[model samples]
Target: MKYLALWFFIIGVVLIVFIQFITSQNVKRLTEGNKRLLAEVAIQNRLRLLQNDVLTVESDIRGVVITDDRTHLSNVNDKIESIRREVSALRTDLRGEHAETYITELDTQVGRKIVFSQAILNAYDSKGKEAGEAVINTGRGKVLRDSIVQAVHQLDSIRQYRLNGIISNIENNGARARFMGVGLAIIACLACVLAFLYVVNKGRQQERMIQMLNESEKRIKEGAFIKEQFLANMSHEIRTPMNAILGFTNLLRRSSLTQQQQQYVDYIYSSSQNLLTLINDILDLSKIEAGMMHIEQTPFSLNGLVSSVQVMFADKAQQKGLQLTINVDPSTHDTLSGDPVRLTQVLINLLSNAIKFTERGFVHFEVRCLSQTDDEVVLQFRIKDSGVGIAPEKRKAIFERFQQAEAETTRKFGGTGLGLAIVKQLVDLQGGTIHVESEVGKGSEFIVRLPFRPIQNHTEAFAAPAEAVLNPVRGMRILVAEDNQMNQQLIRHLMRQWQMDHVMVSTGREAVEALRREPFTAVLMDIQMPEMDGYDATQAIRGELRSDVPIIAMTAHAMTGEKERCLSFGMNDYISKPLKEAELYAILQAYFRTADAQPAPAVVNLQYLRELSLGDTEFENAIVRQFIVQVPEELGLLQEAVQAGNKGQIKSIAHGMKSSVAYLGLTERLSPFLHRMEVEAVSGTDENHFQEDYEEVRRVCEQAVIEARALLSTSA
Candidate 1:
């Protein structure tokens, strides 16, 4: 249809142009003929004027001869001069030889007539009327006058003949012009109709194209949804079996096994860890591609973070007999606000790569403060290694995901090639840049520059609290809510190994029922379960049972927003599946450590708040009190928004509270639910599930308020 419309438009334009071109040519030819006709008429008029002037001169001389008046003689002279001037002017418009001959003959006859008239005038002036009459009667003047008239008459007859031909030609041209005008008018009307049809057809085609685009968009959205679901399912299916393999391997290594058995278990553990790393890298790349990865800026120790990343590679470096050294410039500050985790991750990847490729010599890590001000700090990190350096041509390709500098390098030093890619992404997320200087077979150095907001007037930076000797929560019953059989056994084994009394349930509902029947020191809630999910179960425990027992979220979802989602559902902390022994132990230690040291339980860490207040005890107290006063009202409103189905309002409130939660160092306990609520609110799908989710967040907030007040009272 669109093509047809275009064709119609083209035809209309071509027809109108053709008609105008043809009509203009005809008009031009007719106009040229009319000019020639006008020239002929003008020549004839000049000849008549010359003849009249000659006759007038003759008449004026005769009048002078009769009246014997000098005025008449003067008039005769003026008329003769007028005839001469008219003849000269008319000669320019004359064309062919015949026309020129006629003009020349007329001039000759007029001159003779003028001479005769002048002779008569002179005779009349000197001798009077009888002498002039005698001159006129000689018949010479009459002959000249008759000859001039004959010349004039011949010129007029010829011009009139030409004028008649011009008139007939004009009539013919008029008839043709009328006929063409009618044809052109018809063509113009047809062109207009065609153009109108084209416009209408084009409009319809545009509507069809719009409809097609809408359908394509709908299909694309559906495909994206399917992709998300596939990723989620893949994550669950892969992690479930991996959990059993790593968990049982951990159990086997702990048992009194032979050295050979322990070595085999170690291989299994190592392979599982590698697999998990690969999975995480793939998922991270996916999140980045989806634009869901967010960089967090929080106050952290810059030097401490570097040291920690350095420590991560120390074992591998030592295994390879490589010396690792860290040099920090004296001007570098200790505390800055940035995403320490991402920064550390990038550094770890660089150090690991450096350590992996280097056969000998030391790997040096250097940190320097490039610039500093009261508001911002720019720092540079350089990782230098004695390794098989990359080729100049391959330096850029190395940063691309799943691309290695050389195929041989991949076979020699096995890697997924995603390390540098992730590092680059992480650096960019922090608004930093990474560049490399390398020469093949010599060495390579990776430099990173990051800008961070300074922690102003900060006297001391927060460090991790020293590890205290832990004792199990004796006589305290712990509840584990998990659906996966392997995970259940895994948690059960860990709890038994720690010599703690615990109960395991396969569903969230069973866990909640058990919690109601007996008090537990802590609850481990798995997010996905068959009967009553962890969210609803936690809400039951916190709202219906009114229990404040610390609940930790356990799940296979290690995605970007998963932790926040878990915390928002009243969970005090979160840990991913295929859990590490140390991470599990850490969580247990945090809950159980205070059982022996503190006189009462401490539900919140006040380190962040205390640091923020800059040692002002009054300010800390006021801030805590504000959190206590405002959170309940915010929670109530959040609940109302959820009930009203206002996801935007819910997201806004949750996001606002997230900052306070982080400032107070309550992120582990509060972030999961709040973050999940905020993220889910944007989707605004599954309204019933969202309502349940919000209820869980409200319950967590209410519990958090109670605990925060208790901590504030203790601090006071």
Candidate 2:
């Protein structure tokens, strides 16, 4: 290898020397040729200028003679001076050339021409038009100008001949240089080929090593990609069951239970919530590492955001027996355009860390407008905790992934050490800066500065009332396509609680089939399912079924783009797994309350009956008895439709009797089933299985009629 390298270097040096010699020779010749050509061009240009100047003087002299204008005399005098300067310039430029001889002769002729022109101008000035005309008629000025013009032409011709010679020489020199360069290039290329052979033999070992390194790098990248995919899948898998646990726990908390059981449930809820937080931290870290995390800028309320964060940590702070303080500057605008979600995420991570590390002392959070301009607002957030502070050396590493103040800190605190890491990444994504200051055994303070654009003509965001009265529209039926048994049960239980009529399906295929068979007010779709996924199902519902039914994506995948992916596939909105009761209720309220469909009036309009009766008890009783008799037959028909798998008939009967059911004040309980029957009838799916709900509706309706009859009797 050493011998080959030595040989390659020797050949390379020789090749370079040969090529450089040839290139230098060509460059020198081209440079000399360019200089001579420029000189010839300059001489020829001067001769042309002198000729034009003399012609102008002659024309001006004639103009003075003919027009007898003093202005013409001034023009002639000016041109003569210009001719003199041009002649002097030509004399200087053509000093050693053949044009030098003609330049002197040309200079003399130009002087004589100027003398005659001035004589004509003087004639016009001192004598008059007659004398000037007499001088011009004599033809002395014309003769001198003609002589100068001829001399100028001779000079130009001589320069042209010189230029032609220079160009011919340049062409000859270039051709010779090119021929010589070609010969040298051939020799250089031969030497290069031999050098290349020597280098190739030596470089084989290095190339093999480089190839191995590249393969190693590729494997590392693939491993990282696989790890990210595994984490994403694990996130979905874990969130699925976690959702069920938390969702069921929320349901259980609302039910009647013993004090001990309730306490146990609370513990379970808190532990589950913590587990969810840990999972989220891992997923966020994975995304940030994979470069998949993005910051979204949307309009949000600053006051609301801060208050919500305060509320979130308030419980934990109380449990830890530490005071938590949140102070917001009044000067901060309530509405600003920014990624409030990411901002909130970063703040929560910082606050949680602060609260967790601090056991005895208080944790203080403060937000103030550091600066405000017409378009942007810079907010300064400081989270100071009077807990165990970090040592000076460890402060910098705390924000790194999977790092804490020290290894012991992670063991003592029982955290993933990813909070600050995520916090730092999120702040950077938002074009913000975050820093921490700490002294061991005292405390730590984390400060973040973020800039956000101010929202123009922004309306303050209002939180829904805690106990929002949900007057669910009558006959509002929704379709839920959930594959998980627990999730399906959770949704069913919630739907019943809200008195919302809905049908449950196990797959996207079923959801699509159901939609085609019947009309639903909305569809709650789970993303991952058998037979078909939620995205394809939504597309089918939108295209094949041409149904504009709002499809809310219930997904466990909490990746950054999950919501947009669902929305792109025609989902109206989305809610992540382990859905919160408030979010579900809010979604329902937003969908149903805003629907143009009005609520069916309460059971039995007493006012209508009173007006019809005209204070007659017998007429009201007869009316109640007739309604009772007709309802039994309609109920039997509904049962028959369910038995025969006649969805159309069942829907027709449900819609026909909905008014009477409303009149009996049974719409709240019976209306849900009636709405369900109406929706299922259109779906034409598993009609026989729907009898259970139909039977329940029957029982409620019968009991309602009985209660109504007693009311009628008493009122009469």
Please tell me which predicted candidate would have the highest lDDT against the true structure: 2
lDDT of 2 by residue, 83-102 (tens): 77777776776688666677
* Reference-based lDDT, residue 142, model 1: 81
Question: 544-572, model 1: which lDDT tens digit per residue?
Answer: 99988888887777666777777787878
Candidate 2 clashes: the total is 7
lDDT of 1: 0.75
Model 2: which residue pairs collide?
517-682, 518-682, 603-662, 603-663, 603-665, 604-663, 604-664
Instruction: Enumerate clash totals for all models, in the order shown.
Output: 10, 7
TM-score of 2: 0.54
Q: Model 2 off-target regions past 4 Å? A: 1-229, 331-334, 456-472, 593-716
Measured against the true structure, the TM-scores of the candidates, in listed sequence, are 0.62, 0.54
Worst 10 residues of 2 by lDDT: 458-467
